[model samples]
Target: MNLLKKVTALLLSLAIVIGSIFVGTKTNSYAATSKSYIKELKIGKTYYYNLDGGKYKDKIKVYVSKNDNLLLRINDKTIKVLKYDYEYSKHNYNRLPYKCNVRIYNFNKKDKSLEIVLNYREDLQEGYRILKFKNSKCLLDKIYNDSYMEKYDSNTGAITLSEGNWGLFKDFTDAIGRFGCYYKIQIKGYKIYNPYTSNTTEDARKFKYTADKNLNAYTNTNSSKIAFTVKRDEKVNIYSFYQKGNKKYIKVKNSSGKYGYIKIGSSPLFEEWLMVR
Candidate 1:
């Protein structure tokens, strides 16, 4: 009996020894093989980078220079993709290079797919573009358009356009409508938001803020609410202002021009959601 127990102990010890060797070798192997492809370059308060961001960097030079206009360099191919919001940009923001950062948004080796999000600084996303690559080449360069971005429909995860029954969906987007063909694009990282209800300008106060929250229009300054629950994305006009205790509230008119009291921060202090000529 004692001999059998000793044999069992020996076997257990040998198994543990083998396990440790396997784990130790794996750790060292991974340490030796693992690599990072992104490099950050900062100049004063500004930032730039060089990225092995998948296909774009596979056979060419891919990096961002410290120029105020963020220049994306791919070999001899350079594109001015982003510009900080300057005074001149305000008048022609739509016509200028969008605000963006230099980074690897995505990469995949098995599928040979690479995706990138050009995050623009403005609240309006109509100017942004997402670059998609397949098999070491660019497959699609899609810009943000109302008709297409809304199709995402609150799907904040990676989605591909390859498998779709879009029918005549091309009629909506600004992209050249190509029937019987679809490009693969990863749509998860784009910062999607409704332009009607949310503030879009860099200076929130400079732009007319809208009602982003579902609020109750009370009969008076009291906590009691009326029958109306101000609908989402509806225009709110301040009829008057009032203060109760340490809190401030506003008397606002709904879409029907019906006056009721709404809690402070529910309506904009400036113009409406869209500037009225």
Candidate 2:
């Protein structure tokens, strides 16, 4: 009886050990399954499409939930619902009506890397389409004028010739007379600010130009003879004009009034610079 009791107790202990191991394995598997393969995207995160390998063809909005489901909205339509499964190294899904011909990526917040692959079909015959967003925000770099001559005084940070000399010219001809009686100025390194500011107010702004009808070309300062014509509705960097030592020269200006000179006679002034605002 004594031996039998000892054997019975040994079996019970062995059984408990085996059961504990089994339970641990199951718990681990369940935990792994609960994790999601796709990384969570924050609010306002966007995915851009590659149309011709040079520009963004389209964009998609990513909405992440606490339950690990990813919601994809394209052109205001909810097109995809992905389940987050963490056990696998990669997660992939396919659906129909892939009009944008772009891939969806899981935006990883930790390393700022996209982890998932999103593929779509496209038609080459159609030219690249521009992505439209109703209330989305985009990042824009600040542009500065590099070609103008910058001078720093004790009171002012950097003052260009155009900003200081524009007042010197009583009229448009007076400004032109300083530049050998020519009606054009060359500008370079025009910086485009993301959120534009003015002397009176700060607001969203883009680059713009106003030129006389005779001077319609627009180009970066380095390029020869205005590479393109300025459109009335197009956004442009403001090129500041100033005079140096009683001579008139064109310069690109920053918001701070710092200016850079552009080549003379390279492009004609379409109108008096006054109309550019």
Candidate 3:
């Protein structure tokens, strides 16, 4: 009977130890999974809370549940319970309505950084609606026209153009339209000179001049000292020009395919300094 009692006690002890180990493992696993969700969040990028169990690095299937909460960190500061009680499915995780407000700083300059804040709720039934924060405006705006251009001046921080006139623009838009065709600047009457040739004028003749592929050119007079050529009948956008003494240098391209700044003149074929809108 004593032996039997001893065996029973050992079994009970083992069971208790196993239970404690199981509980500890479960807690650790939960912490690990939760930590993964909050890792590598950019300061100003918005992220939705996903309740489904999945990895965070890639697109993960998530299912929303009422008990799920999102942990957020901004500017190295921990923010707990930014979003709560959100439910989602793996396929429709992004459709769920818990959203954070993200702002991009210095987007015009080279140093672009993000700042994010949680100030909105996602309503799946009603689509996404932005909840305006105190003194904050909505980020997204509707398109007013089919073709539009907006220009901002860095010098004065003033918006100059909503549409019309490329000359008023400081920078060119990189997007292409459906037609896949646009305008460019064309240059004429520019002379190419070679500094190395003994007969400078004659040597200039020897260097076969060609237009650049993009139908643009740079000037030899600038600090860059780069000469670009352009092909004939090709279009290019014109920016600023360089001027020295009595000569004004305009950026252009040649018929043979080269791009750079060229001197403009009244030659019949190379008559007009033209820019396509």
lDDT of all predictions, in order shown?
A: 0.36, 0.29, 0.27
Which residue runs of candidate 1 sit more than 4 Å off their true CA positions?
1-69, 77-99, 107-110, 123-128, 133-137, 145-277
**In model 1, which range of ten residues has the least summed lDDT?**
196-205
Q: Candidate 2: TM-score?
A: 0.19
Ranking by TM-score: 1, 2, 3
Best candidate according to TM-score: 1
Q: How accurate is candidate 3 locally (lDDT)?
A: 0.27
Query: Candidate 1, residues 82-166: lDDT per residue as tens digits?
Result: 3443334545655655344433433333343334445344432222355654343454555543211212212333322211112
Could you arrange the candidates by lDDT from highest to lowest?
1, 2, 3
Compared with the true structure, what per-residue lDDT tens digits does model 2 show for residues 1-277? 2676446534533443343222212122122321232333333477554312223444566665555454456445534543233112123233323222222222223222222222212221111111212223221111121111122121211222111112223233232221111111211112111111111001111222333332333244444555344343232333334334433434434333433433344343433232221
RMSD of each: 24.2, 31.3, 28.5
Clashes (N, CA, C under 3 Å) per candidate: 0, 23, 41
Q: Candidate 1 has what TM-score? A: 0.28
